[model samples]
Target: MAPSEKDARREARRRAAHRRVEPDAAPAGETAIRSDPIRVTADLTPELYRHLGRHASRAAEEMDLPRVPSVDLVRAWIRVSDDPLVWDKVIKELRRAKQ
Candidate 1:
């Protein structure tokens, strides 16, 4: 025995509806994480991702040791990369950490 066309259509609609937002209401004044998702258009090599993951892990470890604002971390990274002197200082600090 085969399923009817109506049954198939109903199942499809049900699946589509299920994919939509849930009906459960949320309490007022609740907020979630604010940072936007980072987009990457170009393909990232496996090595690049590995390096990024390592860098992020190290930064997270440092943050755990000494809690710092995410904005401050981002600003520091930007500033250091923009200035050769600051970049040198940052590299020195990283080397000191390894020692």
Candidate 2:
């Protein structure tokens, strides 16, 4: 039996969703890393939460970092904590050179 119009539209959507890009097809100076996302939950005491808020605010003022929520700071730390060596390298470079 012939496929219905709805089936054709579904097939088109699936193809579009699964479309892959070749690295060479990217424009100059562009690179891409593909990975699945991970979700984690945290529970902190009220004191620690307050501490994080104060520290984040102080860092923003003293270090000129943008002020983000404490939870965001925690989330970002968790994300970048995977590579301590790279973090150290970048921190050293940033300290040596003006951003």
Candidate 3:
């Protein structure tokens, strides 16, 4: 089959898998990782939470992934910002946010 045809088949399978689970619930056999007691947490404002959700949804659609969890995106950002330039930008943002 052509690549497009293969991708279509894969997408169809993903949709089918999604349909088998409840809309707001994790799929069967999936344990909730957040239930652990020793987890680090950050409090986000409602606006920021919604923004993250929108970004994650757009990223998932653009990448043709099943879902893009916001935590994963934040982790990627942290991983990529190891350079001094990135640190400077972060400090600048923090200073701006303080005003």
Name the best candidate (by TM-score): 3
- Rank candidates, TM-score, best first: 3, 2, 1
Q: How do these models rank on lDDT, best leading?
A: 3, 2, 1
The lDDT per prediction is 0.62, 0.68, 0.81
The count of residue-pair clashes in candidate 2 stands at 0
**Residue-wise C-alpha lDDT for candidate 2, range 3-96, written one tens digit per residue:** 7886986676555444435334544223333344767776778987788888789867876777867666777776885798868976887789
lDDT of 1 by residue, 5-44 (tens): 8698667656555645456633322322224566535456
Worst lDDT run of 10 residues, candidate 3, spans 28-37
After superposition, the stretches of candidate 1 with alpha carbons farther than 4 Å from their true spots are 1-42, 65-76, 86-99
**Shift in Å, residue 23, candidate 3:** 58
lDDT, candidate 3, 1-99, per-residue tens: 899998987786676567657567566445222333455699999999999999999999999998999988988878978988998999999999999
Model 3 score (lDDT)? 0.81
Error of 1 at 57 (Å): 0.5
Give me the runs in candidate 3 sitting further than 4 Å from their true place: 1-38
TM-score versus the correct structure, for each prediction: 0.32, 0.37, 0.54
Of candidate 2, the 10-residue stretch with the lowest lDDT total is 26-35
